[model samples]
Target: MVLLLFDFFFHPFVPDVLSLWHQEFDFYTLLLSVVYGGIIEEIMMRWGMMTLLVWLFWKVAARKKQVPPYAVFWTAILVSSLVFAVGHYSVTALETEITTPVLVRMVILNGFGGVVFGWLYWKKNLETAMAAHICTHLTMQAVLVISTILS
Candidate 1:
């Protein structure tokens, strides 16, 4: 609930976010985003990368004969989230047509979203965090569709 509000309200003030949403506003686009963005994105970012990092960390801990606790779990979330943010920045860099202002807004929005996902992981668990992330993407797509219909 809080995260949804953050995504909605913060987007307008952040320039390109609302613009990006508007750009993606359409029935076909919304459907594609739900399938690709909502599911595939979360799978790659949270489940794929983050899960791999956690596994590697576990292997290291096992080699050292030390069992990591909750702190280690939280640290893993933070590290993975930072990596995700960096990846997002790289994507922005690759976009030749993206303006400086739009790039800045994208970085901020993606980074903020990553942070929220990390916090959710810490608060609940990986499953909950992934659900929240997916929800955000799905909700964004829905908002785009609804707004297009209204306007």
Candidate 2:
């Protein structure tokens, strides 16, 4: 809900890096983004990277325990989310200037969503996290389409 409101209100003030609808809206790109962003990102960030980070922490830091501690789990989520945010910037590096402000904005805005999805993946399941991501993309695409039509 907060994320939705953030998109509704503050999105225009932010850089296009954080905006959902970037280029001219095409159904194919929208569909592709929703599907790819939902599935592949979650698989990479949550299932693969986060799981590995947690397991590594468990192995090195908490060798006596069967599972990682809560602190380690949260560290994994945060680190993985930071990696996710960094990945976004890397993809767009050629187009945009990598200023401090832009980097901060990307980290905070996208990283917040990453943390939410990571938490959902940790607490609920991967499917739930993917659903949230898909819904987010779908909602943004719907808003863009409606606004375009209305305009």
Candidate 3:
């Protein structure tokens, strides 16, 4: 997908925030990061923020007694994703020398994840989206472990 491509290309450009893994690897540090950074952050961003925004929008729409089209949902996803990217940018800038490409990739990837979450929301429900988000975060932890072991 376009979003995926953009993310892949741009992620390296995003300034690194919190260089937790410097020089030799630390197993405990990785574990802590997986617990706090991966799990906690994913829950807060994808499930908490994304889901809450959708519900709030739905509530507002229901109050207006207007059932907007799926475009409304798409818009919400896009907006939330942008905000998420911006938040990451701030964090990244604080810790790393973010290049343009890194920032672009980070934004693109987050946006793509938002789209998937939005789709999950439409297909199954908000809870399903949260599950998907958590699964993705778990997978990232697995990736980190595998990479560390391999290298």
Candidate lDDT (C-alpha), each: 0.63, 0.81, 0.60
Against the hidden true structure, what lDDT does model 3 obtain?
Answer: 0.60
Which candidate number has the best TM-score? 2
TM-score per model over all chains: 0.61, 0.82, 0.62
Residue 99 of model 2 has an lDDT of: 70
lDDT of 2 by residue, 1-151 (tens): 5565655455566567555544357889778867888999999999999999999988989989876799888999999999998888875566577777666666776788899999999999999999998987777778778767777
Ranking by lDDT: 2, 1, 3
Model 2 ranges with Cα > 4 A deviation: 4-23
lDDT of 2 at 45: 95
lDDT of 1: 0.63
Which of the two candidates, 1 or 3, achieves a greater lDDT against the reference? 1
User: What TM-score does model 1 achieve against the real structure?
Assistant: 0.61
**TM-score between candidate 3 and the true structure:** 0.62
Which digits, one per residue and each the tens of the lDDT, describe model 1 over residues 40-140?
A: 66667677776676667777764464665555566676777666666666555554355565555565666667767766755676667667776776776
